[model samples]
Target: MIESPDGERTEHCGFIQKRGTNNIAELTAAIESLRRIPEGAEVILCSDSQYTLKGLGEWLPGWIRKGWKTASGSPVLNQEHWKLLHQEYLTRKVRLEWVRGHNGHPENETADQLANRGLTLG
Candidate 1:
């Protein structure tokens, strides 16, 4: 879910792939949100998954430095998505925030609802 500074809120969702993990879903959400937000805008991209936030905040740089490989020389799990997200991430001023999931965060609840809706969509 993307919320505007004027209190406007929007939900984004879709079938990412045949199968995916929560981390992938989080990355997808961040990617989609970053794409939708205008360039040079202030962004607070929040997620419940540490894997996604950590990848963006910490692991992404190392992965890039290591040529998209992990510290152990294995390929990063979601390189394609990470690449896109990283591209968008660099174009804006974004504050990555980690929110506790299912703890009554309105945006998180909306995101959950949107995700559930995706399960029923074509």
Candidate 2:
């Protein structure tokens, strides 16, 4: 979803791939959300996937430092997405917020439904 500083908002969902993981969906959503908003815009992104959140927020620096390899000597699973997300994050004012899913948070629930509906399109 994209929201203007003035409070105008938009929501979007789409398939990242025919075979997908939760992390991919989460990252795809976030990347698309960032792309939709204006450059240098201040925006808050919310997601339930800890993999996506921590991967980009907490673990990104080490991954980049290690040339995108994991601590266990494996390559990061979604290097391209991570790089794109990190690039946007560095170039834009994006604040990522974590939200617990299926806990009856109205917006979260709605987003879940939207994501589920997107599966039918694949």
Candidate 3:
């Protein structure tokens, strides 16, 4: 995430996560981005995954109460990360923004790099 001056009291925060087919990894990155910010600060979350954006914001709570199962009774993938991210969201202040991927945004580029770095290390 990159924080730049946005007038006096607010800062412009930019976040990027690597492209992933797995919804969980991308959502995890989004949660991580939120966690990196200070509490009560306004944040702008930029992500390429609509699933991650909508799932966390819209689908999560129901999934949690449903024992991490999909509406059709299939076990949800990446339940642990989902739960962790849910907890993280409860503790931080943020806003979500969707950005087109691979458009050469700097923070997006950096986050892609960081995500790849984690992949390589594992």
The C-alpha lDDT values of all candidates are 0.88, 0.81, 0.68
- Residues 1-122 of candidate 2 have per-residue lDDT tens digits of 55576777677778666677878788887887778877887778788888878887899999989989999979999788888888877777767789999999777888898898888878
TM-score of 1: 0.93
- Candidate 1: C-alpha lDDT: 0.88
Q: Which residue pairs show collisions in model 3? A: none
The predicted structure with the larger TM-score, 2 or 3, is 2
TM-score of 3: 0.69
Model 1, which residues run further than 4 Å from truth? none
Error of 3 at 41 (Å): 3.2
Candidate 1 residue lDDT tens string, 32-115: 889999999999988888988898899999999999999999999989989999999999998988999999998888889998
lDDT (Cα, tens digit) per residue for candidate 3, span 9-41 = 222222334444556568767666667677767
Using TM-score as the measure, what is the rank order of every candidate, best first? 1, 2, 3
TM-scores, all candidates, are 0.93, 0.90, 0.69
**Candidate 2 backbone collisions, by pair:** none
Superposed by TM-score, candidate 3 places the C-alpha of residue 109 at a distance from the truth, in angstroms, of 2.4
